[model samples]
Target: MNLSLQFNPELFRDPNRFCVYVHGLPEMPVAWVGFCRVADVLISPDAYASQAWRDTALTAPLISLTVTDVCETEGEAMRAALRLVRMYQPPINLRSGPVSSRSGRKVMCLETGVTYDTAAAAARANGLFESQLSVYLNRRSTGKIRGLTFKRV
Candidate 1:
């Protein structure tokens, strides 16, 4: 599917060749808005455990995405991440209203939790597939959480 994201047009022109970052809704740094091939980063369990996700544990009770979303195949997750980045903006606030993409894909932002499951659940409900959420989290797959283990916030 062609997400047709508008942030970095040239970089995403060829979705098959590059990796993209799209997770960390609450902590996604503004500086990460671009295309890159540095798909070597890994989001260790300890890395995803954040206060933001925990803060909304009771109210949100949702996930952002899942292991399945990013582990479908090689580079598939990257493509998904690019789709997310193209569709949404920074600091994904789960408490806000839904945002629509040019193609009419509406994604409800979620407060980032401390665990992968929570993040995935929230993102999955919004619009993202279980394919690329992990790529957005770690930049690359470490294959450590194939079973999708996460620490509860």
Candidate 2:
């Protein structure tokens, strides 16, 4: 989905990519507006205790943004995001725009809690899947959770 983020930056256009930070609602920085991008998010096996499937998907609870909506500056997006984190309680899955593309590089992933669903209707009719977005938070993960930035492996 092509969406407008709170803040548009030259760096975002770079293939190097950027990061989106999510926090607990109660722990939001201030007033946060939400954003969505198609960037690839990282997941770790011990993600929320190996709960990647639900956490990364729209099933996880809401989180706080780094910025607040009250702030209308360069980082206004960050401020808005922070406030959002403070507002929403989680187990809510939040997302940005669509996936960003690079010349020949596959985006790296860092997911933790991973769930699998083949039939969205069947999963939900059984009171299993929450929405048509077939997803769940039940799986075994042996993945790694990277830090905020990257380093040579």
Candidate 3:
């Protein structure tokens, strides 16, 4: 028996929805799933490239996979998804808030030209999102900040 089968979410999303399939090795592909509105804040583990392939049929909750892990192996990618879900699930309360909350409105309070990959390290170092850039800017403090303009990337 496949023990991994128990961990499968069996979640599904519509085919027409905006989806991002971060390709990995030929044998492994990780699909980041969500609507366009919440493209920045939330994502779901919609599909994976296994020996057998399948697509989601209805939207499930956001799975919160990080951009940096986009290239990891299939197992690593899924573990990362579960880690992110455990990390961000409670306070953000994706299940309880209005649909708009998924748009990063309640979470991503700051914006910069910094791509997700650029600031991910700094954000992780600070134990927060890149929003700290705004804090540095507002204080007029000299910091390793970049992208002066503040709009969603």
Candidate 4:
């Protein structure tokens, strides 16, 4: 019931395809992510205590049991994931012609050194897998913006 959650997204070229972890997991540890009435972000208390989490899966998506509460569920996880996405949105500064309308090809125009987070990459709740949330908010501004053009990237 009690768990700790830590988000250490993979360091691969594409941070989206990251792994997740559920900390303080008993024989059967579960990573609960939904929105908790108490804390907006609750990770497993002992999830970060594991050497495996630090050494091996440090960057992997970790879920600590200590982050759980009386009202927690996958649904709430989705909500929290979405809420995080909204909160972590970066400033969009379109620079270039109308980009395409593809999925991955669609690139956003964030300031240099600014990148999306795990939760922001996840366009929706379904996109949030385990503890690693995908960030996709800074997507290029597409469509006619006050009578402008739109594209993917």
TM-score against native, each model? 0.21, 0.21, 0.17, 0.21
lDDT of 4 by residue, 30-80 (tens): 222443343322444575456664453334333233332221333344344
lDDT of 3 by residue, 19-77 (tens): 22221112112343331112232233433332233222122222223232231233343
42-142: candidate 1 lDDT, tens digit per residue: 35444446565344432352333112131233335434544454444342333322332322322323343234454456346546544333323332343
Candidate 4 local accuracy as lDDT?
0.32
Q: Could you give candidate 2's per-residue lDDT for residues 1-153 as a string of tens digits? A: 000112222235442333333323232222122343324333333542344433443343444223212222323434334333323224233323222242221122213322222222334443431211222222124222210111111
Question: Model 3 segments beyond 4 Å from truth?
Answer: 1-112, 129-144, 147-153
lDDT (C-alpha) at residue 45 in model 2: 33
